[model samples]
Target chain A: MVETFGRHIRQSLGQLSYAAGFQLFLFKETFNFLGKRRIGLRVLILQILFTGVEALSIISLLSLGIGAVIIIQGAQLPDFLLGEQLYRILIIVIARELGPLLTAFVIIARSGSAITTELGNMVVSHEMEAYLSVGIHPVSQLGVPRLIGMSISMFLLTVYSNVFGLLGSLTVSSIITRVRLADHLSALFANFYLVDIVASIAKSFVFGIIIAATSVYYGFSVSGAITEVPVKTIRSIGVSIVLCVIADGIIILLTMLVTA
Target chain B: MIDVPIVLDDVTIRFDGRAALDGLSLEFQRGKSTAVIGSSGSGKSLVLKCAAGLIFPEEGDVLFEGRSIATMGEREYQQMQARTGFHFQDAALWANKSLGENLSLPLLAADPDLSDYALHGKVAESFASVKLELDPSLRPAAISMGQQKMVSFLRATISRPEILFLDDSLSFMDHAGSRQLMARIEEFKDAGATIIIATHNREFSGRLADRVVVLSDGRMVASGPYQEVMSSQDPALLPVLRDLV
Candidate 1:
């Protein structure tokens, strides 16, 4: 029993060390690409289109649905129970929390899985060897562009989700409660804080890095078989979502401390 | 006499408690074609990979042009790699890029100052040599396996690398296609490129290689000219050579 337990601990530590080393290599290559101006603009632009622009319609629709639901449910509560500052609740829930989280989930579902599968297939086919043989750094040619693009996409999508969700909520509130559009807008603007925006953006940015890095790492980790691609993709998504949530909790806690 | 360009000194590689290469040491003569021949699971490909610096050995060193590859810095390693080209056994083309873009990206990586016109001309020249006339916009999936192999060969040699490594790269081709491709390889050889190939095809090796090394169970059993190795009576190599001939 002791031997088995010790072996398990050693295996876990080895995996952690491997992961940390790969992340360091990725960051170093990313900075190397930036310093040398070898940023592969064409790849970066395509990644932005795939991760950001292509995801806009679904994100907008989902945000609108979420916002309408929130408003409809909040309207059922009595004013005496929550006070007159209902928009404060809406802003806190939507902009400061759900916006970044939902946007990250969408990206993880769409681009994260795709990145992992694509890279995993490349590894299985020995295309990574082809890249290395040609003196091209795969991290600079592949990783950096995806990293920067995904980070930028996450930030933009989070902001977009906030805007559409707020607008949808306002439309629903005006229709149901006979509130003026101007009044709803005024309440939202009044309640929203710069700290909230900062926290949301920071969360999205960090989530983007985590998701991209994790996907690429798992993608390259695949060896030998085609069956490993889907397995790695699932692993990439699961790990990315967990990491994003952990990061979100930490950021929120820090933001609350600073604002308090 | 040409200087040796690559040396594997007492190299050993192990995987999952099994040694794939066991204390293998050999020097590849510059400007000559050498063929590594072995049965499946005999570490023929591992030797090529180790010499190319694609796989570091577990126990010894690989030297390219008198400099140890294990000790070379990133810049120096990249510089060394720029002058060497490796054609994978699977003909590993980048799936995301079209065939032309795949060829162009490496050339651009090596010399970023190359103009688009010059790059296009280079790509066209390589395709023309292989008698491959296809839309450059098409991905490898659109092409047949033989065409993909040709594209991989062109990608490896398009920049005219000084050291070329071919890992069973011509196995998919027929006799005519193999001859055409080998003729093109001869052009590279005539231009003084060092060529190392791992192949089971006896006729192919006999046609191209000056020296042939036969391996079995991760150790070199025979090494010399192709005809000499084939004619040798060494007990360990006899069975493998008989099957090849």
Candidate 2:
């Protein structure tokens, strides 16, 4: 029994080596995909449209509602805490933390699963095999477009979410807290550092790559069987979420350390 | 007489300890139809796959015109792929795509330069060949199984392959449909293309093949001109051939 277990373990390790080589092949193919001018541009545009602009709707609405509620709460705050610290609270939540994280979460939910399943099904159906047989690497042809699209989408959405969230908060503060626009702007500029903006941008970018890669990896790793498809999809999503959370935590800790 | 276009030299493929094709050696020649006949578990399909470069053998080699397919570089592989059409057993049509989309897949795979309009025209020609007048936007699930088979055929031939590999691609068709398909295959054959099909239907094989090769337990049991092999067969295949007739 022990010998059998050892033999299986060695066999699995061998398979894992093959899988790793396959992934490297796929990664190189992605580089080729990025080199294509027309198809790459068109795919990028589609991703920005689908992953960025289209995905912004729900996050924007949520930010707006949150901003409104924050303003209303500030208005009712005992006058001491309401005066100078109101805009600070708004900036910290909307610009620094809540906006980027929530936007990333939304992208993972909406676009991540779709990209994974699409690539996964391609692998399951022997399209990947077909591509390989034809000497066109599947990763270069299929995956790079997705990686580029998702990354651009995540970056744009994060920027948009932050900007919109700030706007919503500003409107609420103006209407409910009687805070002057000039005062809010002066206060924001007084404390804002280039590092903070860089950190937020960097966080979103890393999150985008992680989401796209993990999702795609799961999808492309499915063995060709009729019954294995649904199982592959479930594993892909579960893996993507876990990876996203871990990356998010690490990014937060690193950024905090750097900014401090 | 047709010239031999493909040769499998003592090729062996195994999956998990079970041999799919064990030391199988065969040849498929141009301008002739060769039917690979086998029982359900026999690796007739694997031979076509090895020829198509979809599967690699653990032992021996698959040769296309004396050049090893397993060792060809990417450029050579692409050139070979452009020269052959492989019809998957289940059609393997993209369900999310329409009938036109499925048919156009091979064309798109070979040449990304084709415009949508030109692609549509070429797709129309393939569909016309296969007797399908499918809408460009109608998805696969919306089509009948026979129509799906036709769509797969259109996809397979769209690139104008020099060698055609059909793996159980004729099983689902009725007599009329099969006859129509055979006529199309004959047209392809007349164009100087080689055809190899793995099938169980004796009628399909009997009417179609110039020669037939029977595979049992991943080994070539008998092979010759279809009628000659059928008449002078060993007892192993005689009963099966009689049943088929």
Candidate 3:
């Protein structure tokens, strides 16, 4: 029983080491592709369209719903208790926290799974060999564009989600609580500091890199079977979400420490 | 004596504790066609992959033009690859790209300065060689399996690499199509390109290979001229040689 347990632990460690090594190789190849200008602009644009532009409507609707719920809940509390501080709360929650997390959730659901499955299928089909045999590096041709596109898209989406969430909540407040839109806007602008913007962007950017890199890592790790594609896709999503949350916490903490 | 362009020296490959290839040493004569024949699980395809630098052997070296491919830098290895072509058994065409794009990628990678018209012209020439005149915009899914294999052959040879490797590339085609493609492969050999093929098809091997190497249980059983090896009654070769008969 001890031997079996030890074997299992060893296998897990080996798998982890393999994954870390693959990520480093991918990171080096991505930078090499960028430096050499081997980046395929057409592929980059397509990824952006798929990961960012195509996600706008869904993000808009979800952000609007979230914004309204937060405002409604905050208003239900005693005015003497919350008062003008409500906008500050909204800015912190929506802009600094929920915006990046929710945007990454959408991306992990959509683009992350797709990247894993697509690359996994390519491996099973021997299309990866097709790329390698021709002297075209798959990581350079496929991974780099996806990495750059998803990272940029995630950052932009975070900003978009925040704007819609803040605006949607203010619109709801205007109708339900008789709060003027101008007053809400003033409070938001006053409380929304530069650090908040930096923190949100940093979180989204790091989360984007994590998602793209992890998805590609798992995708390339697939071997032999078609059934492995879905398995890797699920793993990519789970791992990417967990990493994004941890990164969010770290970034927020660091930002607070620096500003304090 | 014919000059050798590629040599496998004391190569060994293992998978899951079993040696797929065990200290196998062989040289491929320049501008000559060689066939590696073996039963299933006998490491025929693995030998071809190692020679092509697609898979590295666990022990020993693969030398191309007298230099160890294992020691070559990435740029040098890529340049070496650019001058070589490999056709997979499954054809392995990129599903995401159209047939035209699949054919264009290697050509463009080899020479990025080629004009669009020039690329189209080269692609057209290759399709015409195979008597295939389909729309280039069609994806591999829209094509038949036989056509996909033919496209893969064309994709591999379009750049006219100095060395070509075909891993059972003609297995799926009709006899007539196979004959035509083999004839084209012959034309490639005549142009001074070294050709190596791994196949179970006796007639195909007999027709194309001047030298035949028979493999069994990951070891070299027989090696010589095609007729001599096929005619050998050695006990180690009987099982595989029976297929040729």
Candidate 4:
């Protein structure tokens, strides 16, 4: 048993060494990537296309649906509770948690899983080896664009979702009750802080990095034929969600503690 | 005449206390064809990996065109990669890409300067030479094994590499198919490309290699011209030679 455990540890160390080496290669690639002024601009453009424009519609729809649902549900509450505090629920749920989580889920479903499968295919086909052979680092060439795009996507989508959700809440509230657009905006802006906005941005960035990094890690670590792509992707999504949620919780707690 | 195309000097590769290659020394001359034959786990593939700079040796250096690849930087390594083509046993086609995309990858990676039309023309020409009609839109899964092999072969040559390595690339082919592929390889060799094929195919090795290297248990058992290696009096090579005949 001891021998077996030792063997496992040794093998794991070797594997870790391989992964660490690749990561260092990725870091070097990233440094080189940042040094290239034109590629950065191109990457920024691609990021906007990937993370901004691509996210607009879904964010709009999801936020609208959630806003409508919240208003409908809040309507069922006793009049006393719904009268003054209804907007607060919309602000807290949609802006603080639901918007970001939903945006992350969208990315996972649409882009995150796709990145894993794509990088996985690259790994299995030895394209990574080919890239290395040609003096191009795979992480820099592949990972940086993905990391940048994903992080940007998460941030943009969250902001978009929150904005649209707020609009949705106002629209729904106006139709169902006596709340005006002016009142809704007044309440929302009154409660909003630079710190809160920064928190949202920071959370989105962390979520993006986690999603991109975990997906790529799992994708590259996948050990099998082409058929295993979906399996790896599913695993990546599962891990990303768990990590994102934990990270979100920790960040929120940390922010609260610091503020208090 | 071109010095030595590649030089492996006293290279040793050990895995978990087991020697995959034990202090092996060899040379591949410029524009020549050599075949490495051995049974499973005899470290034939390891030699190719070492040559391609995929695996580092515990000892010794691999010199490509006189410069050691052991300490070669990213720029020099990339330059070396441009100068070599490699095909694996399973073809290793990028599954996510269409055949045309796969063929264009190395060229784009190596040169990044060629016009799209010129790249397309080069790709078409390579496919033409391989005698495989690669559909511009067909993914790797949509192709047959033979077609995949052909695509892989074309992809290897897209960069017009000076040296080519094939590790059991023809293992899955039928005899006639193998012959045709070997003939294509010979054509590449005749065009002044150094070719090294690591295989268990005795007959293919006999017909294709100018020099045949016999590796057994991580050591070179025999090395010489095909006729001589195949007719060696060494007891260890007797069975391998008999298998060839």
Question: What proportion of the real contacts between chains A and B does each prediction keep?
Answer: 0.64, 0.26, 0.55, 0.34
Candidate 3 chain A: 10-residue stretch with minimal lDDT: A33-42
lDDT for B226 in candidate 2 is 83
The residue-by-residue lDDT of candidate 3 on A139-193, one tens digit each, is 7788888898999999999999999999988998888767688987887798888
Question: Candidate 2: lDDT of A101?
Answer: 78
Interface RMSD, candidate 2? 2.9
Which digits, one per residue and each the tens of the lDDT, describe model 1 over residues B144-240? 8888888999999888899999999777776777888889888888898899999888887998899999999899998999889988888888788
Each candidate's interface RMSD? 1.6, 2.9, 1.8, 3.3
For model 2 the TM-score comes to 0.84
Candidates' lDDT values, in order? 0.88, 0.76, 0.88, 0.78
Please report the TM-score between candidate 1 and the true structure.
Answer: 0.96
Query: What's the TM-score of each model vs. the native?
Result: 0.96, 0.84, 0.95, 0.81
Q: In model 4, how large is the Cα lDDT of residue A244?
A: 95
| DockQ scores of all models, one per candidate | 0.67, 0.35, 0.60, 0.31
Candidates 2 and 3 compared by lDDT, better number: 3
Worst 10 residues of 1 chain B by lDDT: B236-245
Native-to-model Cα distance after best TM-score fit, residue A147 in candidate 3, in Å: 0.7
Name the lDDT of candidate 1: 0.88
Clashes of each: 0, 2, 0, 0
Clashing pairs in 3: none
Index of the highest-TM-score prediction:
1
Report residue B166 deviation for candidate 4 (angstroms).
1.8
Candidate 2 lDDT, A108-188, residue by residue in tens: 778877776777777666667655544455666666777878888888888888877777877776666576867766776
Over 4 Å off in model 3, which ranges?
A: A1-13, A35-39, A80-82
